[model samples]
Target: MTVSTDPGEAATAAPPVNGNAPGRGHRGPVWLALTLALGLLLGIGVGLVIPQFLKPGDTSPEAGFLRDMSTHHAQAVEMSMIAHSASTTPEIISLSSDIALTQHAQIGYMQAWLRDWNLSPTSSQEPMAWMPDAEGSIVNGLMPGMATPEQMTALRAMTGKPLDVEFLTLMRQHHLGGIHMAQEILKLSDDKNVTWLAGTMVTAQQGEINLIDMLLKKLQTA
Candidate 1:
């Protein structure tokens, strides 16, 4: 999986920044507010965009899909946030920001569904139980495309080009796994909103994966 780009190609690269400069304290709160607002708006948009979709009872496949996909979307958002903060590549930053914003909105969307259904965030049954066929797709006792604790730790600790490469790799895998889950939900449930979201995930993540592959190739050659 190693890209073939030369390390010497990065000779002009700026050293990674380690500490925040003065008077940046308010920035964090402001960014947090913006992110939260975006998520809220997107969540409401999902509902209003297609209110005709069937409302699944608490224990149905629709509920399970929303619950499981929310967890999945959360990780993608986390990894993207890390990449946006740490990776020096402009391409990586842009890609990460796109993923973070989109998935964050989807998280809010799924959570809103659960709230409307009067269901708990989690189900009594095991995760992914909605798609019995996907049980074997689990990795390290987790769902498909999840980064293990070690991988997430390494990602957080890394910076610069290394961070860019590793994040691309991890996200590529994550997107593949997520696409699988989304595709399964399309087959398992017919709720219009659910199907639309799942289809969107497939299309959007696959497009991201292609962009990542291009970036990886460019990095390898750099």
Candidate 2:
């Protein structure tokens, strides 16, 4: 899929400073505003393309997976973006940036898939009915890996090492939840594309979980 990101979200790393200019104070409003704008722009772009992916089929497995996974990944992106600004640990900052980039691209891809499948990005059925086994993981009737509104609000409020630690903990739990959903998709989805996407998720998130585990240990030690 031709998945392009918002140019504004591109990273601009700072090289070692000359130690002359006092470091600019990290402005929360600036970072948060930029993050929100970038997310909204990308979301708009995705919505525009999604309708093209739909076909005549009412609700295909591909459509369902795309719809649900897009929602799930949006949380990951949001959480990670929060960590990108507020996290103190270098490792966590790097990890969150990676997640922000990766999930944004994946969201774009799934949005494209939904457009190709001829389905609305939104769904009517109870979430996770595509795989009955998923019933066990529901929280407040939503599918697994979704952060509660309160949790999301609290994540936005955290900063420094506390933010890094909490982001790692919450995101690890989120990935585990997603792993279960992806496994179900692997088994229940007949569409080759959907099954392949599920397997990709399993492999990617498993690797990320291991990395997050190591970062968690590093943060504890530091």
State each model's CA lDDT, in order: 0.87, 0.79
lDDT of 2 by residue, 1-222 (tens): 564475543322333345332454457569889999999999999898774553425465556667788888889999999998887677888989998898888888888777766567888866776666666877796668677888889889988777888899889988988888788777766666677778888998999999989888987998
Global local distance difference test of model 2: 0.79
Candidate 1: TM-score? 0.74
In model 1, how large is the Cα lDDT of residue 170? 96
Give me the candidate number with maximum lDDT. Answer: 1
lDDT for position 219 in model 1 = 93
The candidate that achieves the highest TM-score relative to the unseen native structure? 1
Candidate 1 stretches greater than 4 Å from native? 1-54
Per-residue C-alpha lDDT of model 1 across residues 4-84, encoded as one tens digit per residue: 466655533433345543444548889989999999999999987665455687778889889988988899999999999
The per-prediction tally of clashing pairs is 3, 12
